[model samples]
Target: MRPLIVFSDLTLDGYMTGPGDDLGFMVDDPALEAESTGELRNVADAIVVGRKVFPEMSAYWTSAEGDLAHWMNTAPKHLLTTDPSVDTSAWGNTVLEVGDGIERVRELKAKQGGALVVFGGTATVRSLIAADLVDQYWLKINPVLTGAGGSPFTALAGQRRLTLESARAYSSGTVLLVYTS
Candidate 1:
């Protein structure tokens, strides 16, 4: 079974983005970037994302004409969405899973492959966490504070315990915290 991982950058106030989906408040540390890129490479065969996040992310990563962009553009991706009519031609090796998001994720995790990474869907992350399907969490704690904005983590019915597997500080003042549940 592959491990399910959730990755996110959060502000001091616990927000993932500022007003109108402004993510500029998140600090970018060079060392952190290097560490994240290295970790991302370990992710195997597939990337999972929610419907709402797919189009934008797919467009950005696929259209980017650089080394990193080329690599991500070619990776296999699975999108869980209520809307089944999404055109995936732009995203190579992309598939749409039309069913309960959590169930779909479970099915994916059961498959023989590398780590399955969930990038930016807050709702999907909450669902995965509640279902106890996520094995690892890579959270980048940014230095700035966004007074009010989007939250990376949604409210849960109960508390979920996690152990800090590793922690590293970057020269750019960003910290990467890896946790296992």
Candidate 2:
């Protein structure tokens, strides 16, 4: 089975976004991004995202330029959404999967592929984590601290012990922590 990985950017306080979904707290270190994203794109051939994240992610990446956007535009996307209203025409090479998100991801993992990577789906990632389907977590912890906000780790049921695979400190004060459960 192909490995499934969750990719998320979190603050030192473990928040994904600040108030009003303000992402200004996120520090954009080009060098850090190139190093981290480049490595993942090399091995990941597909991207998985939840319905809620698909619209925003699709809109941004579709018109954006850069190696990451290029890869995102070309890579096969598996959108797990039961909402029939979602239109998948904006992005090419996308498969609109309707049904249980977890089950669909499980099915995708069973198929022949490189690695399935999840980008910006908090709830989706939480479900996968709860199901114990996520193989690894690629978390980028920024230096800034958001006093309060939304966290993917919020309300997570049970306990998940992760083994630290590697730790890398970037010049931008951002740290890349890789963990496998």
Candidate 3:
């Protein structure tokens, strides 16, 4: 099966995003960005996102320039959504998937691919983690702390033990932690 990797940016306090989905605390970190891009480029050729995150990502990456944006724009994006009104045509190279999100992801894993990387909003991450579909976790821990915000680990179905694969500290005060189930 093609692996499902969860890619997330986290605050030191473990919040994925501040209240109202604020990402203003996040800073530009070249060192961490380079390392993360290198890792993702090697492992994934496709991207998966939930309904809430799809529009945000598509708008940002479509006209953006850079290696990451290039990958984001070119890679086939699988969007899991139950809303029948969503038009996939406006978002280039997008595939809209209906029904159970986990099941859809499992089907994707069975197909020919390098890896399916999941970039998520809070609810999607919670579901993915709860379903135990994630094989690897790439978390970038930034120095700033968002004391109150949404957490990917919130309201988990059960406990999941992860083995730490590697940890690297970047000059920008960001730490890249890799863990596997």
Candidate lDDT scores, in order, read 0.80, 0.86, 0.86
Which regions of candidate 2 fall more than 4 Å away from where they truly are? none
**Tens digits of per-residue lDDT for model 1 on 1-181?**
8998888887777776777778788775656765576667777557888887788888788766644465577778899987888898888899999889988988998889889888866667777877888899898888887688877556566787899999988876778899998
lDDT comparing candidate 2 with the true structure: 0.86
Candidate number with greatest lDDT: 3
Tens digits of per-residue lDDT for model 2, 1-181 = 9999888888999887787666678788788777776988877899998888788888889998887888999999999999766789999888988999989999999999899999866778778777888899998999999898767776568787999999998888999999988
Native-referenced Cα lDDT, model 3? 0.86
Model 1 stretches with alpha carbons more than 4 Å out? 65-68
lDDT, model 3, position 5: 93
TM-score of 3: 0.95
- lDDT tens string, model 3, 50-125? 9987778778788778788888888888999888678777568898888899899989999998989998877888
TM-score of each: 0.90, 0.93, 0.95
